[model samples]
Target: MKIDIVSVFPEYFDVMKLSLLGKAQAKGLLEVSAHNLRDWTHDVHHSVDDTPVGGGAGMVMKPEVWSECLDQLLGLDTSAGADEPSISQGPIVIFPNPSAPLFTQADASELSGAQQLIFGCGRYEGYDARIPDYYRAQGVDVREYSIGDYVLNGGEVAVAVMLEAITRLLPGFMGNPESIVEESYTGSEPLLEYRQYTRPTSWRGLDVPAILTSGDHGKVDRFRRDEALERTSQLRPDLVERLDCSQLDKHDRAKLGALGWDLSGEHPRRTK
Candidate 1:
């Protein structure tokens, strides 16, 4: 897969060259390039932001600068008006916005299959809304996502967080591909991953769960599955609320029921 990142602080992405991401680049499995948004500026100061039109507290990233950068990156014609978009089918455009929907593992999974991605990282308050609006109107697959509820100074960090999640799912990107299957937030019915253990079963004083050491693989799997349910319920009941009842076996139902889950509803929920 290919990715282009546009940020005023492109140097922040230099770390992309040091890890498994770098190895993927070496093997030709991925291509990532970070460009300075200022490169598209024509003025001496290379100004990319301006006071908000509505008298906001912080400066808003200028739409004109973003348009020039995004247009060239998206292969859209600057000359083309709102009626006629270059209509690129190959690359999907993404912008990070604090007010947008949360970026999820499911989204990352889906985007891992894209041929190319262009990420525009906004600084100051944010880029003008029309940037994404105009592109979407032109038949482009434009997406805006927030990493979380909190705000960040810029989108560069959010882009980095999202890129790691998406790129690691690409085929051959991970050394052990199976590791991706059972991880938390994966699968049609996602769950928090079971706790991991390694080395001496007894570390200091705390002992590993005895079931893990037993020679019975079936029992170990069952134990892990049960632990996953319990852990997720304790940590992220929101995931539990969305559990697909059809996918739950009798044992699974019993386990959740024991944990105060009310299975009688149209959807699973914790009555308490």
Candidate 2:
């Protein structure tokens, strides 16, 4: 996969050169590049922001600068030439903003399969809304996402957070694909992952669950599923509410009942 980032602080991505992302790039599994948004400026100051049209506390990112940078990266030329494909044709464009919909693991999974991704990192008060609006009108798969409810100084850190989530889902990026399957918020049901332990059976007087060390694979699997259900029920009841209870068997229903789950709901009728 190829990822391009446009930000004033391109150096913020230097950390991507370390750890799994670096290895992924080294192995030809992924290609990531960060370019300075200021590079597109024609003025001496290379300014990329301007005061908002409406009276606002912060300056907004200039759309023209973003347009130029995107055009260069996407090979979109205004001059009449061979019918050149628009950059939006191949790359999914993402803009991080505090007011946008929250980013999700499911979104990362979907984007992991894309051929290319382009992130427009906004700073100050964020980009002139017209940037994404213009691209979307031109048929670009544009998405505006927020990492969480809180606000950040810029989108650079959000871009890194998103990139890490998407890249790890790419094939061969992780040592074991099963690890992905069993992780929290994955698979058909979005349950939190079960607690895990390794190495010392007894650490600081806390011993690993006996079911894990029992060598009874079936029992261990049951324990994990139950733990995941319990954790999700306690922490993310919203997720539990959306679960497809029809997928549960007699044994699963009994376990949920033990946890005080209401199985009388139309979706999960109690089995005789």
Candidate 3:
């Protein structure tokens, strides 16, 4: 996949060269580039932001410079959509905004299928809202997602977080593709992964679950399923709320019942 990042601090992406991401680039599975947003500036100091129009506290990124940068990258002749690249020719455009819908594993999985993606990193207060609206009207597939509920100093960090999530899902990117198969937030059922243990069965004082070392795969699988259900219900009830109760077997329901989860409804809920 091809990935383009537009940010004032292009140096931030240098980390991409350090790990599996770098290996992906070397293997020709990925092509990544970072472009300085200020490169499109035509004036001295290459100013890209100005005081907000509605007397806001912080400066808002200027759309003029952003438009020039995006137009070139998106192969659009003008902001009005002139000579706009088609779905096949253009890449998906994304912006990281704290106020936008939260980014999720589902989103990452979907984007891993795209051939190319361009992420615009916002600074200061943020880029003009019109930027995304304009491109969307021009028939570009645009997305604005927030990594979390809180805010960040800039989009670079959010881009990194999202990029890692998406790129790792690409076929052959991971040394062991199976590593992602049973991970949390993946598969038909999104649940936290069961706890893991390494050798030395016995740790400093605690020991690996007896079931794990019993050589009984059936009992071990049941133990893990029970643990995952309780762990997810305890820490991420929101995910649990999305569960399809009908899919839970008698054994699964019995375990959840012990935790006060009411599965009679369309979605699971903790009674108390």
Candidate 4:
């Protein structure tokens, strides 16, 4: 896979170039590049932002530099359709923002299959609104994802997150594929599962669950599912609805019900 990042802070990309992603590049499985967004600037200060058109709190990234840089890198006219894949092309413009949509495991999986992925990191309040609209007109799907509820200084961190998340999902990135499938949010189960540990048999007076040491896969799976349900109901119940309980037999529901779990209704304190 080929990944391109457009950001003012190109140096921030060193993290990606030095870790697992770096190894991927070394193995010839991945090609990643970070371009300084200001390179397209023609001014002495290389100014890329200006005050808002109708008086806003912060400056907006200028569209000219972005358009020129994108055009040169993509080797296409500014009005060209971004989705037109010829002999070699990939998805471009995965922007990070507060709106747009939420990034999910499905999105990461889809990105892992792409031949090329481009990220546009904006700063100074926001980018020229027209950029996304323009890309949308060209039938290109530009994803604007928010990492969380809170906002960040810029999209650099968001880009880092997206890169790592998508990169790790690629084949051979990890030694064990089961690790991904059984991960916290990878499978249909959206909640954190019950996990037990092995130690002094007791830790701070809290002993590990007895079922974990029984060496019974059936019992352990049921215990883990029940614990997952309890934990989700207590912490992030909103996720419980998304979990795939089809794997659960009658035993699973009975265990959860015995623990005062109300899976049929929203959590007592609903946030979603």
TM-scores for every predicted model: 0.96, 0.93, 0.96, 0.86
List, residue by residue over 111-168, the lDDT tens digit for candidate 2: 9999989999999988999999987876678999999999899999999999999999
In candidate 3, where is summed lDDT lowest over 10 consecutive residues?
A: 79-88
Query: Distance from true position, residue 82, model 2, in Å?
Result: 9.4
Q: For model 1, what is the error of residue 128's alpha carbon versus the real structure, in angstroms, after optimal superposition? A: 0.8
Regions of candidate 3 where Cα sits further than 4 Å from its true position: 79-88
The digit string of per-residue lDDT tens for model 3 on 149-227 reads: 8999999999999999999999989999989998999988999999999999987998999999999999999999999
Per-candidate alpha-carbon RMSD to the true structure: 1.6, 2.8, 1.8, 3.8
Q: For residue 49, what is the lDDT in candidate 2?
A: 90
Give the better candidate number (3 or 4) by TM-score: 3
How do all the candidates rank in terms of TM-score, highest first?
1, 3, 2, 4
**Deviating ranges (above 4 Å) for candidate 2:** 80-89, 266-272
Backbone Cα, N, C clashes tallied per candidate? 0, 0, 0, 0
Whole-model lDDT values for every prediction: 0.91, 0.87, 0.92, 0.77
lDDT of 4 by residue, 1-272 (tens): 88889999988988887877888888888888999998999999999999999896999999898888776655454446656523234466798997657887778877888877889999979899998787666566677888888788889999899888899988888767677775656665666667657778778989888888888999888778777778777777667656445555577557656655544543322332
lDDT of 4 at 246: 54
lDDT string, candidate 1, 148-204, tens digits:
989999999999999999999999999999889999999987899999999798999
